[model samples]
Target: MYFVDTLETEGLGNRSYLAGGPGGAVAVDPPRDIDRVIAAAARRGVPIAYVAETHVHNDYVTGGLELARLTGAHYLVPADAAVSYRRVLVHDGDEFDVDPVNGLGLHAVATPGHTPHHTSYVLTERGRPLAAFTGGSLLIGTVGRPDLVEPRLTEELARAQHRSARRLVEQLPDETAVLPTHGFGSFCSVGRVGTDATTTIGAERHRNDALVKDVDRFVADLLAALSDIPAYYAHMGPVNSAGPRPLDLTPPEPADAEELARRLAAGEWVVDLRARTAFAAGHLAGSFNFEGKGRLATYLAWLIPWGKPVTLLAASPEQVAAAQRELARVGIDRPAAAATGRPEDWLRPGDHLRAFPRATFADLAAVWRTGARPVVLDVRRSAERAAGRIEGSLHVPVHQLHGRTAELPEGSEVWVHCATGMRAAIAASLLDAAGHRVVAVDDDFAVAAAAGLPVDTSDEAG
Candidate 1:
């Protein structure tokens, strides 16, 4: 009956849980930070029994395998699941009995549809269900979406998801405590679930809009709200399926401003790990402004180049230390140093370094209509463009921009746009340094569409 919930928050929030008996515990859907889970297990004076995943996750990087390797725990997934990892797969009706040792038992209920082989765990204290950990299969207020696949498989998957939700509703008791793997803000849960981390099945059954007993409508509602899933989702799925790589928890130290400047010249990204407000107020020219103060490590791993040397511009010494810890969570080991003083002091006159002009979607559209005729560089990924893109824009993803410099005319003025401002800013700076006049259009397409600019759509989109 011992249960622990770990919440990971940045732009995307993920929750992982450790639940089990006395001698050994089981980790369910552990996040990329395995140290916290390991530390918690050490505090409880128990060895990990197994690291279990409810389904193949498409959001945050899964840390289950790392936990398994670090603690010598078995890695478990649903039986017959087509994943990349070597695991002890459990099937429906499979019982993980810990009763003989610690008075707890776990039963695996095959609940497909979120993926091909999703499972829900029913924990029992004395042959009675106490809690159910429904991974992505069911959230607090919504059921798993059935249409994550291609159009050919969307309906099939949706139907399977519908049946899965109905099966869980039919089998599980109303009063059973329910803990889902994701919450609000998760790309996986999207708009279906609310923000709360945990709730009872009884509460969900009564309050959940998607679980209203009209299965077809439930499936339709879930599918209709599906937007373009983040590339990180599919990117992390294979990582989870195979097993999480161990992250180095010790982040490197910061170099002085001069040294950081040298590193930046050497093609390193000096990420300012401050807040956007801090970045907007004043920051080192050319510093990428993700400033993920809290989940600094997560975004560092996600957006910035992995294992690349980083120069951190933290607000304080404590913030620097916190940044180091966060980076270590995801194995980003090389952080060069904090700037000598405030980030502003480093911005001296005559430094060709310039922050790109940031514009909202509406503003950019207006600029596009002007006679200036700036070259619009769509810095979003090709997959994102498949959904919809601004017309007459050249495709140059941020990752490939540095490599494809030859494609750009050296003196041409470039206007960059991504789904958001973050990538666009980064791309604009790269273009600027490479001798192109660049500006950043920092708005979502909705804003662009509202401005009545032309939008091109394609079938390959999300």
Candidate 2:
């Protein structure tokens, strides 16, 4: 009677899980914020007996150690993990039996490749396998990118990932649940092409690129699919090894318009969490917009320099508090300051709320329908661009745009767009800052396709 509950970290595209039966339960790969996990346990009326780590996370800090400490649950970590703190060191095939009522147990399966110390945990009820917490080893539509560990180890790890995926499916039942930590929307996927967010061992055996390809092809494709690791990723491993500070969800200090401007003058990031429409119509001149409704945590965490002081620009205290919650999941525990209200109210004598025009896909398509020329800037990732893009859009990934501004054409209105408008707003600001007349395509990517705009695939795009 084992059942699994999912906890999605939306911005990171990661999933943690809780498994329980009548006897008790365990949490796997909980996020830095432990309150929710505590609440989940309380709701289920089960004491969490263990908090397990599939690996030392490199994208966000984990709450495993702290959760276990707070709840008095056993902390299970890989035997070779670099943690200086204490944990129940587990090895291949190690088994743990839960309380008598649960009729459930856990079996460790060594499945390295995402990292050297990665391990998967299998849930079994009365010796029958039910599910495997594959973590970053084998993901939904892809396997975890092996290159995040170290430069020299990339190919070796990819090969190991091949072997690991093979062993997992071979040993586990086809119907066994395949739960993973990466590849949902996170940048940690390697050669991910499908849309399924969760899959069974049988499904992976049938279609997963990692399981279906030969070792050489798999390794080649995996290496080819590596994306630029977020600049902030370097700090994650060491922090996890030493131990992350227990999360603090305190709201940031309120900043007046003048103080916020001063902070911006001093080079602090003033991120606007409002929607693209609101941000474009009015925002602090130098502020970056990730749009709090979108993947605020991932993009903001990716773009902002590590340990940089950040002050949020929002329309209300509630928005500021909401943004804080998302940022904290990635271990950005404290925002230096936050200010609410329209930017114009805080505008200094010489300063003004920057306003940029936004266009829908239809507007751009109409331009093409007419004889008018427009410079479309596609700031999506290579994979996303390949999925579909405007035939002639300038293909600079948003992260790479700041440096490649020179390559863009000069005359026509530079229109920026990503899969959704969120990335586009960020790029529009960069282009504007770089002295280009820009229009943010503040609408869904489907709009462009639906409007019968000129679109191309990866081959045609390049």
Candidate 3:
């Protein structure tokens, strides 16, 4: 029997797959951390015979090269992708045997929309199609975003995406399973996505925009809904093209209270990876809170200056280690230094912990009733702000808030909020470190209207 195992990187919202029958298996779009893939293949009682890439990924570094090297498996990459290293150049209609005993193999299908050289692989058994590994081409509900490449190619790529999705549906059987690498929560997805864990070609044909709408309508709507790509994405393509070095997961040098203090004084980044509530309760002054429990990689990589030395302070060594793995996927390879303990342990002599208040929308309303007017800062993205926003609030996306702090009123206490509390805490820390008194609204945005706050829904609110 054929088995397809999914490996999910929840922090980045992407999935990789290992599929085959009894003879051996093939790895698809593996992450930078190749050990996990190695362990998974071991658990399945099969050697990995091949490692394949659907395209030169624009979101995270791929583990294909390293995984193939270690396992002695053939590495398959799109023929047209310009890469420095040697690989098995996969072309359309090419086939490779994954498990000769069970007649399991892979068939390459060119699906150029997510990237110019993007290709989808079909897992076949005995010359019959069983599964389609549609990486960044056809997703569960919506297709992958086409704007990650050059701006001039975006519209052209969108049209290509429509054709690619239609091609999969036309060529595959209704029962053929559709497995995609992007769109769980990754920024690579476009349009409204589904929450379903599994889908098939037949189901997608009825609901996917590319299959339902004409190519012109599908391309138009997709181009309009595209949001800001993460700042770290600009480096991903180049790193993957030239070839990413082997991952270095070894912990960095340890930092004591003195070193932490000196780094903070020297204007280096000392990130605190604790629960947001624990961070808000107390942390070393000037340290930024990224919340190890939240989207640590996405936000940390997005805001920190590229190539800056970062020092990590966490409650335990385990948290620091976990954050290190997440950061490495986005190309923040290693922490300059790390400390494990409480704020008291990280603080220098004569240094005290700093704190800020965390309030809900109800608390915000109570403050307004007392006739105290503080600067309400909405730090959600532009797309979210367009849906609804609190009246009379200044807007700044959290990613851009570091450079735009001067735009806020001087000497005024700022009230910060996002759709949820995680981003609010991040923004609160940024403002706090910048010497501004801040309050983080730890509540859902939906509660704003119910809390009697004036929410503007007009187009101009964004």
Candidate 4:
């Protein structure tokens, strides 16, 4: 059997596959780039027979139905799936043979837990199962979290998942390769911080933490670390359910202040993707300051409504193009114009907002000595925070800060930091825009901790 997996790094690290044999080729966990999978099959001289999705994904759009339409292949989904789509509902014990050119067979195994309709495929070269394509149900080091769908259904989902994993262990040979749809960097993966895309069934059985014999302990531990879904997840389900939408490549030309004003008057968003200092010095008076410094694509899609025309204020022509591409990756491609003016030109004296003085790490340290201790706000995720965070910091994942503004200190000096300088800048600027004195901290967490700051973690923080 010939197998190929395409890796998409945009939102989550989603893996798509193409498997071929004498029966024909089949695609599994299809990505938005349906053409790539189709072209690969054509090169292998095989007609595609199936386009399959292991489960309904919540992190990014799935491209199974699109591939089916393009290749005239059967679109396959688990028999229990709830989402609306034209698909062949395959049940447990279902099997299919693939003859891309000559000899191969693939068997589908029902693996529910990640979602009610999740399934894994067993690839056979001759008569033996050589590999298993576990969708979100299993990863190299982690098992899929069962809480993404509904909190109330977690127990049922976990029970189902435990059974599914055990079935794979009992039915498939120890040598069978375990090829999962997600790996390191995918939120759907079990502790995917640093792991591989594929692992052997025997290896997973021995090494995967979730595969421990104690089913109750494994399920409880998995449920304990669940995270809130990204804000754009809800929109993606409807859009992807219909079909993959093509992204826009042509961005409108540069706009002057007058043109931008007229566009905004018509209810378009003039997004400023500049440094906090630069934007504070002189941005167009009413532009929404996103700064493109945090989870740019994630927050932009969540906070700004799609299909709303946007004018971008980028640092350079290259940045404008890059920003447009990133926005399109998440389906926010309807940009009307991009600004070409220097950062300061947008302000021109009276148009400028009062630039609040911000303290640097040095300034913050100096203030600590004088009793003016600022509230350190660490705007990073739970995983990043685990590595090391400033000692006296309030955790607020940047994506949720806009809605949870009340939790932050009012009228107090706020210092924000992330794993690096970028997200901190975005958070600091947002705080300033929301009428608070703010500063962007450097990457050294120990520096603040050593200086005797307060730090506490909150479950409310995303």
Q: Estimate each model's TM-score.
A: 0.72, 0.92, 0.99, 0.81
Residue-wise C-alpha lDDT for candidate 2, range 112-173, written one tens digit per residue: 99999899999999888899998899888678989888899999999999988899999999
Candidate 1, residue 239: the lDDT equals 62
Displacement of residue 289 (Cα, Å) in model 1 is 0.5
Q: TM-score: which is higher, 1 or 2?
A: 2
Instruction: Report how far off residue 199 is in candidate 1 (Å).
Output: 1.4
Clashing pairs in 1: 248-331, 254-336, 254-337, 254-338, 255-336, 255-337
Top-lDDT structure, candidate number: 3
Model 4 segments beyond 4 Å from truth?
A: 21-24, 35-47, 190-194, 242-254, 262-269, 272-295, 303-310, 315-333, 339-363, 381-395, 404-412, 444-462
lDDT of 1 by residue, 332-394 (tens): 544666654576556545553354456777776687678546677887766578888777778
Clashes of each: 6, 0, 0, 15
lDDT of 4 by residue, 1-462 (tens): 466555454445567788866458778887654566777787777788887778777766666776788678888887777756668888887877666345577788988888877899887776688778898876777777776777799889987877888889889888988878866456566543235545888887887766664788877777766765666767775666566665446666878766876886787777788766676565564566665644567667766655778888877877787677667656665578887657554444455444544345556667777886578887877876865655566888887776676788778878777765666766666676566777777455555555554433454323
lDDT of each: 0.68, 0.85, 0.94, 0.70
Q: Compare the candidates by TM-score and give the number of the best one.
A: 3
RMSD of 3: 0.8
Alpha carbon deviation, residue 412, candidate 1 (Å): 15
Candidate 3 residue spans exceeding 4 A from truth: none
The C-alpha RMSD of each candidate to the native structure, in angstroms, is 5.7, 2.4, 0.8, 4.2
Error of 1 at 159 (Å): 2.2
Q: CA lDDT of 119 in candidate 1?
A: 92
